[model samples]
Target: MSNSDLLDKKLCEKLAQSASLTIGHDVLITDSFGYVVASNDPDRVDSLHEASLEVIQSARKIYHDAAAARKFAGTKPGITIPIIIDSIVIGTIGITGAPHEISQYALLIQQLAQIFLDFEKRQRSTTRTDYRKKNLLREIITYDSRSHDEAAICESAYEFGIDLNAARIAVKLEEIEGRHDDASEETRVHQAKIMECLLRHFDHPQDFVCPQNNTGYVVFAFGLRSIQPQQYLEMLQQKCLCVNSECLTVGIRLRIGIGFFSHSVETLRQSYENACFALKSIHAGIRNSTCLYIGDVVLEKIAASLPDGICSEISAQMFGRVMQAKNRKEVLLTIEHWFQQRFNFVQTAQALHIHKSTLVYRFRRIRETCGLDMYDLDKVLAIYLLDIRHKLCGQSDSRTSSIVM
Candidate 1:
């Protein structure tokens, strides 16, 4: 919120409109770029506030008298001051009038804007508990187990009345595919609306939601003690499916990963890791499912859990040479889809939109190239795991605090 682009344009407009009334002067607001974003005078909106740059660069007040205004084009004799929030210059506010006449009003407006922004920051703090919650979630998920951070996290969770003894599952939602023409601010607004609706949908007494940067959201849902683990998981699956459908309606395709139920913050580390591993499997293109459980990931979980260097070594040993062989693309596609279909020839052929004979020929080439066969389950499992590891290596690492990206 302290960033330049995060400045609330509508709030600035309201400030300009409401403040202009007090002094009988045109109040104007400019973004960090010196583009007038809001003004009491409708025609002045979106125009360049020439003095904004000077004030912003100086991080101090800039005043232009009538004589200086007469010498400069598109100039108004006024006082412009930078709006600094959290020590970052987000934008500026200006009072358009005679420099001497509006000087007092300029100081008053600056103070008023600062007070308003401070109030807004506090509102976000207490209203949604957003600032505090985001920081806590980051700390809990990113810190090492058995560390001082865990004690702090527990204390903070206690303050929020989150039941540490109760079972809680961490669910992560990421927009895997989508396209939109919305500007940054509009996108932020829409995302906020989506989160609000999701918070309501995932409505449990102890459920807590915090957005992960702008790319995704992490939810820690509780109140699972009343239901069996399987039943609770089923209920969560349905909720995530519904949420995914709603997101699709707005041109967002999402992948949701549900972690295991855990009680303590120390174990929550595994839960968050489980969620990331599940998402990595989805991104690995082994399955087309919108939602996956960490427990159901099977060999993928075992394989993806390996260190990146080991995963790379296994992938290079298993399919790397095969992928570099002749007709590699067809072979790679055939082998991947073949395993995805559980070695069903017809299903693999249909998935690849190729004839059964072509698929057979591709398999023959794969066997010849890699000395591997689907009949050998050990080799096949290795390939399956290595393929997932290989694909995950190319995509973003879900483990390194994906919440921030």
Candidate 2:
């Protein structure tokens, strides 16, 4: 801990109160620079105490009598004890009275201060370690091997008992309707809770969660034991459902994405990207469903791999006229649902919560506007491919206005 964080005012005041109650004398606490932080004498707070400075500098106790106190600046007759942690002086605790009268309480007050200082130091150390771990995880998942030394990463992973050769999968959790700023305390609390719940579910030493962005977290779960990848994925999906259900009671919902199993740490980045892609592909129509898998969206992933120009051209050629229609968005959404249902008129209508006749009417309008027969396999394939590209590239709104028939 740094000098500024050595002894906070609240802690100092608590210690001062304890000392005053036990020793029956006015007590004061000072920082390393000798600024009084807490004192039984309310007026003495924030005042400079020269005697405490001397005790800190000398690394020894200072006993001042009435005559000696008069010679020192900002001093009263008292016994001042230096507060030490890890063999370094951090602050001072003083019991005000004549040296002879208050000398007996100096050892007790020093011990009490040390106890609080030690606790604070441990807490700070733990917090620092957690931050380092999070930073390391982020680096491993986001940065390329050329940007960081692979050997050093392996060494660090070994220190944490993480096997670099083990199979792992990346799981991402994102908050739905989470528009709060990243720096807000509420967002931080929510992120912490999400991590806490994930850690509770996967309590193995090799499984770890790291914050991905303002609204999401990425979890890496290594196949340490004998669990199969599919089994692990199912377990994670169930855990996500449970977490989402719990959060719903509090008016928050989470969307979870699971990537395919990665064979080694080198491929973890790909897994993380895949997980994020899957999360982004979550359909807004399925509000009750909270989990998605990369394996389930293979066509979308393939579309994402296509060149941007090719995707744009395909989207323009296939959906141009349909997008120019009055109910462009509705038509596009209906087509998307129809493609998702494998062109089953009955199933697509049921999924869209519309009657079969209404669905047929929409399809007839789409055929007329786009000049593509839905019954033809080649035209259906072309439109389906372009629709996949549009959804994966998030070009629904962008292409609607720009593309022409």
Candidates' lDDT values, in order?
0.75, 0.76
| C-alpha-based local distance difference test score of model 1 | 0.75
TM-score of 1: 0.63
Clash numbers, per candidate? 0, 0
Q: State every prediction's TM-score relative to the real structure.
A: 0.63, 0.76
Q: Write the per-residue lDDT of candidate 2 for residues 1-405, one digit (tens) a residue.
A: 467486867888988988898889999988998888998888988888889878999999978888888887778888888898888888888788977778777897889789987897787787777787777787777657667777777677787787756788888888887764667888877777776777777787887666767687778877645776678778777877887787777666888888878766578878888888788778533222578888988877775577757655765776667556777667667766777788888999998999999888887887787675667756665555565665555544544522332
Q: What are the runs in model 1 whose C-alpha is more than 4 Å off? A: 1-128, 177-183, 307-321, 395-405
Top candidate by lDDT = 2
Model 2 scores a TM of 0.76
